[model samples]
Target: MGSEPGAGWEFARAAAVHSEVWVITRPRFEPLIAHALAAEPVLAPWIHPVYVDLPDWCLRLKKHHRDVYWYYPLWQRLAGQRALDLHREAPFDVAHHVTFASDWMPCGLTALPPTVPLVWGPVGGASYVPVPLLRWLGLRGAAAELARRTVTGACRRAIADRTARRAQLVVGLNDDVRRRFAGTAAVVVEPNAVVDPAARGSSGSSAPSRVRTAVFVGRLVSWKGTRLAVKALSHPAAANWKLEFIGAGPDQRWLEAEAARRGISDRVTCRGQLPREAVLAALDAADAMLFPSLHDSAPWVVAEACAAGLPVICVDLGGPPIFVRGTADGVSRVVDVGPGLPARLAVALRDSESVQRPTPSDRWSSARMPALLEAWYGQAAQFRAGRDAAGNGSSVSSEVGGLVPQTP
Candidate 1:
């Protein structure tokens, strides 16, 4: 129950504060959910878990990477049917698709009763690597990106379009996704990272040191731009900065080799995977986070870095920029993705060397999410009511006041 499933669980807990939550998930997670509920019995009554899975014969499709897409749609159909059956027994006011937070993916909740307002995403997947930056990724990575773009483009017009049109409110993970569904649906931008307030820690204590530590906390994947970070470390602009790589992947060897090749191996450290508490402790000690992910919708590390009051230096391309945007100057840097990205990243690294950490903001805090969810649910209901009043012909503006500001 980590990553996407963890996010779904958090949403259920948050929603349970206001209404009963029926959480539809895979059967494998039932034990984990039960354990979690046993620890916090108060939420047990409000959170109902409904396990849904495809037939045993279809399980093989889940084995392959590409085949999972085929399996997902089939699973959605089954989940939708199950939802329809449950609706007959107990009606729902709002249906939200939480996990698989991608705009191109179809949501089963769309099959809910038309009278029940649907909330789709804090989702993203519309962002892409710039052509020039694609060279940073190896040929295999580049081809994968191209294929993904093709698939996403086709799905956006077909499956995603239908889902967006069916949803009463579309909550985009970033502005790019909001723009993608802008004309077709009522869209609002919100990121998916929800940090615990207790995780907030003091930063900037290490800023004045002659040498600065920039940590990259994520899977060492090709598309994560770890190679670029390593290359930047060798640049004279970032001479004083050392990099720490957390998390593991196939790219670890390449990342290490690249650092050695660039003559900055001494300054680079690969810690592999660490516990969540250790990761937070690392964030508190580091001067900044260097997450130059090419097309990540919302990397949770960025929010965690913010919660630790650590500055973030990420590319202008995806949810990272959205998370760091409104902070005080020097608190974060969003480098543009194009030719000379490593050089530009080096400059950002140099610039972040002396900046004091910004105070942790409540923007991405979980404490604020319940109120935001309440507002989003209210807005979804209003949109549904307005559509019903206008014979399903009118479109309501997706704007709402007094909530956390939408992703800029």
Candidate 2:
């Protein structure tokens, strides 16, 4: 399960239990959803899925890595029209734009009838990547990152502001996103809830191992900080620790070369990109998870690590801190990115046995997210109804209260 689609799939299933949800997504994903829904007879009845097909050129653009923004916005435009038609026929109380979970993306809900309260996000704004770390990426990589930030940040703020003003309630994936759009609307910060049954069942609640075998799982991207993890492993204190690298990307060769240069090639295992089950199995056998991601709003890997009862050694910044409970709480350790980071990581690895197996709280579990969303939908509906009443002297209390029809 990659990030957004996996999350959207989980959210729809979770939301369906308490409400009748009409999902608007790309036509490309309908088959996958249909297969899953058909397999689960109980959930099939509640969700009404509507696929918005983009033009062929836009769809082809989506196949490329960098052109998602081009296709996503165009698809949303079409979805807006489709939503308008649906609204005229059935008059929904709350309209939610769930996927493309970026605060920067203009949501279809913002264009919907104001009487239909908009719930935009569970969205994430760009997370900051330290420039000092980017120096490791060389001149070309550093320049590309700088350029991406400059362009994307400007566009994100402009569009985000537009969505904020119209949304009755905006759900942010982290405090950064909440702060970015706070005053414009009711902002609530919540991390994405991961619902990996395999991870949960496999935890078995075993104690942390004394022989430390740390694992880093994620794409071998520049910001993933695989280099940082490698640097920490090279320290004399971490000579005894073994690390398994999962996932593949451009950085694999660099990591391999770095590991060889550090003379710890034998200790490091680059497993490449494995299946989700394989990754979880690897995590199950490991003592700690090393995820020093430079920038991320809310990463699913951190959630998976926590769910598997694996203590994670991640940076103090971004979504990692929210997932890792830290050594003080006997779950994991959060380290600051600076001169002593490598030493700190070595120490954490050395003391892995002291850290207890962490059980992800209900707050981070999928079971709780739907209930939270249900409450938020209800609140947004009430806010919209109140505004409408004040403006037009018309009452819509009945429809407002049942924004999500109860599953009898």
Candidate 3:
């Protein structure tokens, strides 16, 4: 598992439960892992950093110095081939994978040493649509409809292609992503983890804002559909709303400029990147969340919003709808941007859920996430054991590697 800021947190948390965990982090983030563990009691002993020489999309931080993305297939193709060799040399139990920003993936799993099985963990999360883009394009009627269809198709294709390759058993965070891989993979639209609402200070409200506050958190990229959100503030219905954004990425400069142009600069506030807890706290104060993504899987933000009971304004695009129920109550209109988008959003926001958002984790029915993942893990291990017993060279090892221990 290549180390990432988010992945570091996930791996460390999971390690506390699963004793047989080994972490392979890119060389650049070794300090980050050490620093993170030093601060968190739960992660102190279970995570370790291993150095890998080859880098590509999988290990972008280390390999990007050479600008691997500039030259596509050459480095990437070799990297995929190299992954197989590395596993063969250091054969392990099932390969567990969880990714959000997956630019590239190893093509074939069947050809790996027959002894090892590669299992998909939390596969893909949703992308944040840049709200600014929709406002810039002002796409309406046929133009917005076409754009919506293209993005919807792209999202489906992404799910289908991914499921076809790496997943033996794909765990879905929501029903929508699960539907995309329904026939191909063992789809589980269950969340892998749960949130204890009482554990946190507060989430948000289902009731519409008494104080007109909104939150948007994600990367500052084109597809996030954040542009549309900013423009929405300038719209007649949302004139009173004040928004706080918590995130940073490539398009920060451009997005800020767009907000200023729309004459809602004072209403829109960009908080840059805040800690995870801080972002949640911001959500707790706001009346609703605005997630206008074009293409995405199941967005954790949406789950977080729903779990918090904060009404959300999400396009009925791929991932957003996974958590968004509809505009009826406690949720946004699930707006689909087309001819009538701005007009629809205008009307919907007026009747938006104004009640306190009930914490879904505390009061809702079962999504059955943990059980589904545990089942997938067991099946993956069993498959690996069978392969190794048959003397397949690529088998996940029968014996466990002694728990590597160190200070947190």
Root mean square deviation (Cα) for candidate 2? 3.8
TM per model? 0.90, 0.90, 0.66
**How does model 2 fare in lDDT?**
0.73
Candidates' C-alpha lDDT: 0.80, 0.73, 0.55
lDDT of 1 by residue, 18-61 (tens): 87777777888878889999999998877788888877888854
Worst ten in a row by lDDT for model 1: 399-408
Better of 2 and 3 by TM-score: 2
Candidate 1: lDDT of 346? Answer: 89
What is the C-alpha lDDT profile of model 2 across 113-164, one tens digit per residue? Answer: 7777887777885677777778656576678779878876887778878888
Over 4 Å off, model 3? 1-4, 8-12, 35-49, 55-91, 100-104, 107-111, 125-166, 172-184, 190-211, 248-266, 270-278, 303-309, 325-329, 360-372, 382-408
Candidate 2 error regions (>4 Å)? 61-63, 196-211, 326-329, 359-363, 396-408
List the pairs of residues colliding in candidate 2. Answer: 326-332, 327-332
- What's the lDDT for residue 107 in model 2? 74
lDDT at residue 286 of model 1 (Cα atoms): 84
Candidate 3, position 376, lDDT: 61
